[model samples]
Target: MSNPTVTAAQANKTPVLVAICLAAIILPLSFVSGSIATPVISRELGGSAQALSWITNAFMLSFGCFLMAAGALADEIGRKKVFIIGVSLFALFSGLIGFSSSLIWIDLMRAAQGVAAAAALAGGSASLAQEFEGRAQMRAFSMLGTSFGVGLAFGPFLAGLLIAHFGWRAVFLSSMVIALLSLSVAVTRLNESKNPNAAGIDWPGTVLFTAMLALLTWGLMEIPSKGTTSVEVLGLLGATVVLLILFVAVERKVRHPMLDLSLFRYARFIGVQALPLSTAFAFVVLLVLLPMQFIGITGMNEEQAGLMMMALSLPMLIIPMFAALLTHWISAGLVCTLGLVISAIGLGWLSQAIASQDMFAALAPMALIGIGIGLPWGLMDGLSISVVPKERAGMATGIFSTTRVAGEGIALAIVGAMLAGFVGQGIQQLSLAKDSHTASLAVQRLATGDLHQALLELPSTNALQLTAIYASAFQHLLLWLAAITLISAAIVFAALCLKTVPTEVSETLCEPDQ
Candidate 1:
């Protein structure tokens, strides 16, 4: 017969679990809808390429920058209180985004939405950790992962349908309804939880960390336009390094540190942390790039492109349900390592298929990528929090979420820079080969993703050559991405294979503070 204590504990956990899962679903829905609507928004507002990029980057940057501080605040004050505020702000800003007539206003609104998301994510994850333990905790986190996967899987398709029927404004406006639903559930169900003994917020450390990330991201985004060595880029890069050093120094000395450096001593924690960064650099970045390719290269309409993306998103929804079962049979570390390896192979396959430029040939590889990503997507959140004491759940969730979003943001900047550089070089080379100024201008237009304009301007002879050049440049970019992904897989494998017993690792992670 079940113990009364254990039974009562689980009964109490049920509502909290539901509330966190609902909150988890909201942020990804917001992000993916914005991604799907980017092209339409850009055209309608007559925004520049940089402005278009900012629409997405602004959200990611603010979300990542504030996560640690939000996490610390949740621990210091109360998770439920912070979460309610976050949901309300997310709903408000999301509605404001839909009404904006200018790209600048939209970007500002997106950044504010991201800040709200940070608070909700950190607080919700912490609340889950506080309410569950051991196998129950694993199941709870897996459910949260499944909810996130569901959001990603349906976000684009839903956004497409909304945009098709009601226009791009519908995409942002739709989030308001979701936010209100989540907010109501949270208020009714979630128990207030916090670390009562946790000290005051470390404002200095927070400022330094935020400044470092902002500078690093700005420098990366400027690389394509200003060149790596330009004064603006170099100054930002140098300042980022200095701020990082200062942030580390402050965290080390603070009584209530924002990030606990001691957590890095556990090899298991290190391995789990790498999961987000590597996966985001490879999988999340591809999700963004592939949709653009579908529209620009394959001549697919928005709805068709969103449908094709299902080849990548559907498996994410289905496979996360199996995470707990898989963990029972295999170590979480081994599972994550295998996932990374599979993702690398899938990326290589995708590179080849993209070079072929046959839409049908790409679908199978897209499914492979989906399976690869899905394998570890569910396990990562569980592993990240499980390795730490319950009291520090907010900190663990913050680091995990920060790395996840920051990795995606950084990868996007790097990939954008690389694509622009490759296309520019390809255009210059083709111009010299053809010896026609008109052909050069046409290729330049293609490089900027104005494929229709480029085709209109190109002479028949130059059109074929320019298309070939563009394809070659794209193939080269994908190959580089694949190589980076494989290297990340190797690193994950090595980290997880360290010599340590499972019990010893657990003790190291969960030992009480000195």
Candidate 2:
């Protein structure tokens, strides 16, 4: 016999799930779309490299910093309320981005969109968790992961089409339309839920933590240009440490904490945290680096490079769904471990193929890397809160989301800086550049894929010479990344596979083979 209450709950879940996925598309869409449209934006508005950088950096900064606070707010307030408002604000800011005549105005709007993205993610994910449980919950989060992958998979193509036909403004306006459509669907069907015990925001913790993230991210960004030891970089990083200590001390003493510090005790939780960090090293960094290598070194145009990336991102859309099924046969921990191993293999393969500068030879390795990344992406979110009591789902999502997003920013910065150093060293060995200063300037321009300008910085060098330097330097970088990814996999195994867990986590992580 079917219960009416259960039937109604089941019906409600589908609409809410669709809405969240639709809203999820806006963040990554904005990023890739903006990247494809940057030249168009710059021509009309006029921006120096630093000013243009704020187009994405501002968004990431606000988004990463506010994730935990927004999560706490959703739990303290109502998840449904937060979701609706956040998506609505996202639509509004995205639309505003289209109307801006100045780069600064667009930067401000993008920053606001980031805050909205953080809220929408935290609230929507927690709400989704509340709508389902156990295997059903795992499936729902898999769909969430799929939506994110779908965005990355097609973002460049979609943005290119929109920018070519209707101009760059169409990209943001189209995202706004999706957000509005998502809100309309969710408002009627979504249920309101929150933690009864959740209290007001922890003012001290919120401020300190946000400032800490802002400083840390901004400091990392400074490293590529300013060097690690610059006063600006050193000061910001020093302040970040002080803020972190203060946030921890405040959260411990607060009666109603913004974050529950005790959840860190679980080994599964630690493993879940490591998952995003691993992906950042193995996959996220490549998203940017590959485009540069293809366009700047391999002599592909933007469109061709974007098309080549499809081999890397396309599997993300389906492999995550497959991973969910694989976990039913093996422990999720083992699944992630194997995924990292696969990516390490792909990285090594790519290093070898990349030297040939043949796009076709790179396809298989790129797709392999995508499949490897998708495995953990599919399960990490479900595993995040599953290890904790249901009551703390909001906090769990916040912590995990913050770690994932912030870790990406850090990886990009550190890897970018390291690559510049390697390229500089390679150019010096070539003995074509006039001096160290000329080599440094060439490295800076080449790092950003401004090959024409980079060539200008080295008058004695031809395209072949500069790209050869990059190919050799890039090969070494890929090998280093492969080694790091394998190490991260071992760390993940030590945390999740080495220890025995309770029944809830056991179901989440492990299943006996048939």
Candidate 3:
């Protein structure tokens, strides 16, 4: 078999590079479709707040769990072959989601879609890195970053429009179109990157890793709904810990580990991983909390809030190209770290915003946050793969992709818990302040449904008191977000400040088989 080669004159492979970027773009874009549909689905299915979040978590848990295995498979099989299979499954299941009438069906479909997405995403990034070296990789990566930002940015607005005009079902319908286009381009232009001589798949490592991630993600998702003491959540967490420990032991013994734990030996590799994980943690929290705050506290409709929040997405498109250019002259670590700090500032600013604050004022902070997303989104993988041998690109990309999804899942659970706690404390304070007769009624209204309805029924005599309490509660929640964002910023700084050397070399440093 002859290898497909690029010549000096036939070097116009921008289409292939764009297609690779598009493949990555499609994975996250489809993820947003379900994420933004949660609130709308809740209305349709009489779903609980807990259920709204599970829709996102269900997808993330599956995607994160199987990512490492997907990467390993890409190396064992072939990148192009795995890419096509993943996208076909993704598109098929994504369309089925639109027709789902019940919550259980939707959750099941979402999980399957996640499994398929992990394959496409893992292979897509590895193929891109393998196909384009040095300057070309940088440019293609920068574009990919912009697309990543764009997909997330567009998701809310798309969902909002579909919900307002056609209903939530339209969100899934749109995914079918995007998935088809992505699948078509991938099938036509993408080439394989597998080495036939690479060792067979690490079946033991794959099973253990998937189990560890799934259990942990499930535990995290359950925490806000079941409370920290719930027997089920505790048992899941315990099992996850045990499985994770077992996974580490197994990986050490496997000849060709799915994750290649040895990559941590390189400081650059560690930094690259941290850049995305921390940024994703902070970023996803902002994505989830802001719309909730705007809708719940500010009396804005979902569409209005989603559109206004597009500020976060706009910067994602602009900043990554600059990051690519910066890497041409400066350390990639420094560039990524700077992006994280800027994003932290944005999240801090967001946490400080008051209810009904002007959109422009909020956008000021969001601009910095968008830039932060751009930096890491644009450069982290390029930097990480640059340091590793070509053969290990699939595994490296998989690990990074897994971490990214896991970080988002963890943020969702933790932040959801924080928000519920804040609201619960406020309810307690509100109830305690009322007369004994009114206390029961107040608690009932708050618990029944429709927080606004509960607020409206408060006697005029107690109106001011209840309003003050709600205001205090909202402020406390914002403060908590600010603190978390600041902590994430600190971590990004610490990771980026470490020394690292960058090179445009081939499959040499940190070989996969080592």
Per-model TM-score versus the true fold: 0.90, 0.90, 0.84
Q: On residues 1-514, what C-alpha lDDT tens digit does candidate 1 reach at each position?
A: 9899998979876877777787788788777777778777866886656677777788888899888888888887898888888888998998999888999999899989989999988788778777788889877877888888988888878887888789899888888878888887788878889887878789999899888988898898877666777899999999999999999999999988888887787666777778888777667766667666766656676787788888888889887666446766666666677777777777778778777777677888778877877777877776776666666555676778888887777778888778767766776665533554454455444544556656666545444565566666777887787777677767666666554424444432222112
Candidates 2 and 3 compared by TM-score, better number: 2
Task: Enumerate residue pairs that collide in model 2.
Answer: none
Q: CA lDDT of 389 in candidate 2? A: 73
Worst-scoring 10-residue span by lDDT in model 2: 505-514
Model 3 lDDT tens row, 1-514:
5335645412556666666666666666666656556655766785555555667777777888777777778877988787788878888887898888988888889889888988877677667767787766766666676677778878777777777788888888777777788777777778778967768778888788777777777776665446678899999999988998988999898777777887776555675677666765557666765565455545566688668668777677667777767765666656666676677666667645543355457777766777777777776666667556666665676777778887777666766665555545666654553554344344333322234544654554344444445445545665665555566556545544543434533322222212
Error of 3 at 285 (Å): 2.1
Q: 1-514 in candidate 2: lDDT tens per residue? A: 9889987877768888899999887777777666666655755786554565567667777888788888888988999999998999999998999877889999899889989998998889879878888777777777777789988888777876786678879989999999999999889988899989777788888898888888887787766556777899899999999999998999899897877899887777888889998898888777767866765567665566668888888888888888778876888888988999999999999988877766689899999999898888887877787766776666787788888887776777667777877777787787867876676667776665556667888888888877777777777888889998999898888877775655545445654333
> On a 0 to 100 scale, what is the lDDT of residue 37 in model 1?
83
Return whichever of 1 and 2 wins on lDDT: 2
- Candidates sorted by lDDT, best first: 2, 1, 3
lDDT of each: 0.76, 0.80, 0.67
The lowest-lDDT stretch of 10 consecutive residues in candidate 1 is: 505-514
Model 1 alpha-carbon miss at residue 154, Å: 1.2
